[model samples]
Target: MNEQHILEQRTPQAGRLLIGLYPARYRDLHSEDIAATFAEATEGLNGRALLREHLDLASHALRLRLRIASTDPAGRMLAGTAPVALALAAGECLSGLLPSLTALATTSPQARPRLFAVEVVLVALVFIPWIVALLLTATGRWRRARPVAVLAALIDLGVALVVLGAYDRAPGALLRACALAALVLLAPPDLVDTGRRGRWEAVAVALATGVPLAVLMDSRVTLLGWSWYEVPAMVGFWALLVVSLLLLVHLSARRPDRLRALGIALGPAPWLLEYGIGATHWVVAYFVVLIGGAVAVGGVVHLVRRMLGAEPA
Candidate 1:
C-alpha cells in the first residue's frame, strides 16, 4: 500500500486492536489516543511492527487467566471435592446394595411383618435426620447442622424404644438385623472424628461392622444348604470376627497395610525366627514381635524424616 493508505489504515487499525484488550469504558476515551501514539511511533517502521503488537496482546490475556484460576477459592474447593466425590461413590454403592438385599429378604410371607417393622424403623432413622438437616440447610441454618445430626440420632433411639413395645417371638431375627442396619445407616464411618478420638472411633465402627458381617455369613451358610457344616460355619464366623478385630487393631494403630503385611509375614516369619527358638507357642509369638518391630522401625524413620523437613515443612 502507499504512505497515505499505510498511515490511515495499518498503524491506526493495529493500535486500535491493542486498545480493544482493555475494558470498554477504558477504550472508549483512550482508543483514539493510543491509535495516534502508535501511528506516530511506527510511522517509519515496516510490516513487522504489526506482528510484534499482536504477540504482546496475546501474552497479557494468558497471565490474567492464570491469576484468576489460582486465586479463586471455589476452584480449590472443586479440586478437593474430586477425592471426596470418589469416596462418596463407594459409600453410595454399598448403601444401595445392602438396602436392596435387606428389602429382598424381608419380602417373604414369614419375613414380611418383621421386615415391615424394620423398614418402618429404618425409614424413621434415615429420613428424619435427612429431612431435618435438609430443612435447616434450606433456611440458612448450616451452623446448626451438626447438632441436628445428634438430635436426629436421639429421635432414632426413640424408634428403637417403639420396637421394644412388640417384643415378639424371641426378638424376631429379621427385625434385629434391620435394626442393626438402621444403626449403621444412622451413624456411618464418615461421622467419626479424627486423631486420638479417631482411633477408638475406628475400633468401634469395626466392631459394629464385624457383628453384622458375621451374622450375614451365619445366615448365608444356613441358607445355601450348608447346614451339614453348621459347626464349621459357626467356627468360620468366629474366625472372621477375630480377623476383623485384628484388622481393627491395625487400623486403630494407623497401620492398615501392616495388618495385610502381618498375614504375608506370618507365612515367612516363622522360618526367619526359626520357630522363635524358645517358649510356649513360640512360632505365634514371632509374628507379634515381627509386626511390632516393623511398625516401630517405620515410626522411627518417619520421625527422622519429619526432623529433616523431608516430609512437609
Candidate 2:
C-alpha cells in the first residue's frame, strides 16, 4: 500500500490511544517520531508481533497514566493520604495470617518475617490506593469517577461473600465478625455518580453486610473448624468490613473533597484500635511470633520509606 493510503486509514483517535503510553514530556516533543516508528514497525507484523505491540503499548500507557495520575490534583488528593490509612487497616487485620504458608510450600520459621514483610509491601502498594479511593468516592465523593470505584468495591464485596459461603460449607480458620465491618467501611457504595445521598444508603448496607459476614466467620468456627486457613482469610473478612463502612460513609458524607480527605483520615482510628487489640493478643498468646512480627513491620516500614523516597516512617 502507498504511504499516503496507509496514513489515510489510521484514525487520529486510534493514534492518540496508541501514543498515550509515552511520557507527556516525550510525547510533547517526539510524538510524530514515535508514531511513525510504531506504524512502520507494526505494518505487516505477524500476529505474535501485533499482540506484543499491543501489550507494549498498553504497558507504557499504564505506566504513563499512573505517573500522571499520581500527580493529578484529584488523584493526589485521593491517594496522597489515604493509602496509609488502607495499608494500616489491611496490615492490622492480616497480621496473624500473613506468615502461615501452610499451602504447598514448606515455610521455615526463620523466613516468616521476610515473607510477612513482602506481603505487607505488596498489599500496600498494589491494593490499598484503589480500595481507599473506592470507599471515599462511593461513600461520599460522587464524581464522574465514582462509578468505576463503586464497581470495584462491589467486586471486592462479591469475592468476600464467596469466601463467606465457602466458610459456611467447609469451615476455615478466619477472622472474627469485625472483619465484616472492616470490609464494608473500606468499600465505596453501589450508587453511580448520581448525586444521590449515599451516607444513609451505606449505613444500611453496612448493617446488612455486617450481620451476614459475622455469621460467616462465626459459623466457620463451627463448620470448618477455622483451621490454618483462618490465618489467610484476610481478603474475605476485609471485604465485608470495608463495604459496610463505605455504606455508612455514603450516608453521612457531606462533601466530596471533605469526604476524600476523611476517607484516608478516618481509616487510622479503627486500625489503631484493632492494632492495639491484636498486639495484646500477640503479647499474651504468641509472644515470640509477635516480637518477630513487630520486627517484620519495622523492616517493611524501612522498605516502604526507601521505595517511596520518604524519610523512615
Candidate 3:
C-alpha cells in the first residue's frame, strides 16, 4: 500500500501494544474502546505528531497499571501499616533515649563521654534505616522501601536480642518481639504499590493515633497517680480507642482482605505493649480493654448488617 496507508495501519498496532501494558482484567473490559479511541486520536498524524501521540499512550498505560496495582488490597494494607509502625518505632526510640540520657548525666565526666558515644552509635543503628524506609514508603517508592524496611527490622531485632541477653528482662524482651513482628508484617516481600493519596492517608492516621499517646506519656498521666482531671482524661482516651477500633474494623470488613484486616488490627499492638507491659500504665491497660470491647462490638455490627443485607460500613 502507499506510505499513508501503511502508517495508518502501523499506528493501531502500536496503540494495541501500549494498551497491552494494562492489567489483563482492565484490558478485557475496555480494550476495544481504547483501541478505537487511539486510532481516532492518531488519524492523519505523522512524524513529530505521531511520536507525541505514542508517547502519551505509553504514559497513560503506565499510569493505569500503577493505579490498578495500588488499589490491590494487599498493597493498600502494607501502605497503611507502614506509617503506623514507624510512629511506634519513633516513640520507642525516644523512650529509650530519655533513660540513656538520664543515666549518662550522672556518670563521671570521662565516663559520660564514653557512655554518650555508645548511646549515639546505638541510636544511629536503631533509627537511621527505619527513617529512610519510612521516607521511601511515604514517597511511593515501594520496590526500594521493602528491602530497607526489612533491613531496619533486622537491625532492630538484633539490638533487641543483645539487650535481652544483657538484661534478661521478660517484659522488655516481649515488647521487642512484638515490635519485630509488626515490622515483619508491614514489610511484605512483594512491592506494595501505594499511591500518593494512600501514603498521605496512612500518615494522617499514624499521626492521629500516635500524637495523643505521646503527649500523655510525656506528661506522665498514669491512672494510679491520677489528678482530678485524669479520670475524665482516661475515660476520654478509652472512648477514642474504642471508636478507632470500630472504624478500623468497619473499613477492614469493607475491603474483605484478611491480611489487610489483620494488619489494621495489629496496628495498635505496639502501643498496647508500650502501655500494657513496658510502662505498666493502668490507663493504657484500660485502653486495651476498650479495644477488645470494640472488636466484639464491631463483630455484632457486622453480623447485624449481614442479616439485614446491608453493605459493610
Alpha-carbon local distance difference test for all models: 0.39, 0.42, 0.56
lDDT of 2 by residue, 1-313 (tens): 3654455355244555778767788677866666676676677876555654554455345545555233344343333223333333333323322323232145453668787666555445434434454356445553322333323334435544555566542122123223323333223222122244433343333334334444444323443556334543333334334533442343233322433433433333333233334344532333234323433554565566668987433
Work out the TM-score per prediction.
0.25, 0.26, 0.48
Identify the runs in model 2 with alpha carbons over 4 angstroms from their true place.
1-16, 21-25, 46-48, 68-225, 228-313
- 16-104 per-residue lDDT for model 1 (tens digits): 55556655664566545555556666666665454444433332333233331223442232222221211211222233345555655
Candidate 2, run of 10 with poorest lDDT: 169-178
Q: What TM-score quantifies how close candidate 2 is to the native fold?
A: 0.26
lDDT of 1 at 93: 24
Number of the top-ranking candidate, with lDDT as the measure: 3
Report RMSD (Å) for each prediction in the order shown.
23.2, 18.0, 12.8
Q: What lDDT tens digits, residue by residue, belong to model 3 across residues 153-198?
A: 6676676677755654445545744564444443442433367754
Distance from true location, Cα of 288 in model 1, Å? 14
